[model samples]
Target: MRRFFAIGLLAIHLFNIAGYSLVFQYFIYQTDTNLITKLDLNQYRESELIQFKIPISVPYIADRPDYERVDGQVEIKGVLYTYVKRKIERDTIYLQCLPNRVTQRLSKARNAYTKHVNDLPQSKKNQTGSTIKKSGIFSEYDFKTLDYQFAAPLATASTYISYLSPSPVPGALEVPGKPPENRG
Candidate 1:
């Protein structure tokens, strides 16, 4: 009787372990499938929309008074604004219309550009005048245009840069207050 009871208890414990393992695996699989489904949905939504292809090439410049120029080809539907560069590579995409928030930001950038231009000495301004004219960085209407040029001195113009779609930063959704609950 004692031997039978011991064996029965051992068997029950083994069975419990097996059951727990199967449940845990199912939970993990469900979580993975949920994540994959969410990603697929997001991709489908983005692919269904139209986006403009804009090529941008920004040069790296050291500290200097010279205005760094960015050159790019901006494509809006069939309209194309081409620029001269060693190579043209499509870098970003934009929607047909600008968001209200983006418009506000662009206005701020325009103001900053005006201030910078006003501060420039006459000689430096003269040298950059033609490039700026050709580049159209200071044009009020041009700045409002959805497309942009890739030029040198990109660091200063980082704020003005916009992406076709805002990418979610990795690990951004993690709970900051606590680690995940351990089922074990």
Candidate 2:
């Protein structure tokens, strides 16, 4: 009897663990999350920056986003994010995000970069070079006057006009004693 009781207790415990595991899995699947880790952006290589495009219902933020200046913590569907600049086009959304603490460092780097660029001496725009005027036969020809328009087939224009025209109303024209043609 004791052995049976022990087996029963073990079975109960196993079932409880399984139930909890299933519930946790469900919770994870239901949650909408974006994990912004340090590997997302490399300060040395600007091209390696990670961009997240999420399709969700959000208010129109901006058409052209200035990611550097925009600073805020956004809570999107219960998920918290920092330094995320959003651009919503139609139904889709583009998210540019950076880690919370890294924002200051990025700003500092940007300032230093701009200062360094400004300090550099400006190079002379026009450099004198030896030039030889060409006297080729083709040089006298006026290439701009030549027509480059594509010569489309006459049938294509007719087909396009037909497509643009409104479709005929069904049964709009009925002949006497003839079963109405199903134009549709």
Candidate 3:
């Protein structure tokens, strides 16, 4: 009777463990599926944006102003030259890709870095600029993994301009300005 009772208890424990293991495995699978689904949704949004070009604004430093003062008489001050100064211009935003899971991660990281930079009271966000010059997708065979490469034009000075600007301005540039003159 004692031997039978011990064996029965062991059997019950084993069965319970097996059930828990199965449940845990199911839960993990579900979680992984959900993650993949979310990634897919992000990918879809990125694809949609690829069909249309978005504008990205970047800031650049302009030329600094200088002033000069001259004296006509040895004893009295004569003239003062005042310089005309202009503030830095705001950058144009060119959206290369929409916020997808992968790019979203990149964007978040960038935002965090920007925030940290801004926290430095001395740092200026308006003086910074960035431009996405080229981008493309590449896929790996084994996992069918797709990735993108973005090249941006950045300037430390607020007066700088993008090396390459996207052709056809977002909405304004669409209208034709003037027809080319006929050449004989």
Predicted candidate 1, C-alpha RMSD? 33.7
> In model 1, which residue pairs have backbone atoms overlapping below 3 Å?
59-152, 69-151, 69-152, 70-150, 70-151, 71-150
The digit string of per-residue lDDT tens for model 3 on 1-184 reads: 9999999999888655454444544654554455445544543343333221223354454422332221111111322111111122233211222222432343334445445533533234344454222121332233666899997877564785556557655334565678889999
Residue 32, candidate 2: how far off, in angstroms? 25
State the lDDT at 138 in candidate 3: 35
Ranking by TM-score: 2, 1, 3
The candidate scoring highest on TM-score is 2
List candidate 1 segments past 4 Å from native. Answer: 1-11, 43-184
- lDDT by residue for model 1 (1-184), tens: 9999999999888655454444544654554455345434542343333334444455542323332222333434433322221223344323222122322333344435444544633234554454233223244364444877886765554456545644477335556697789999
Best by lDDT: 2
**Predictions ranked by lDDT, top down?**
2, 1, 3
User: Which residue pairs clash in candidate 2?
Assistant: none
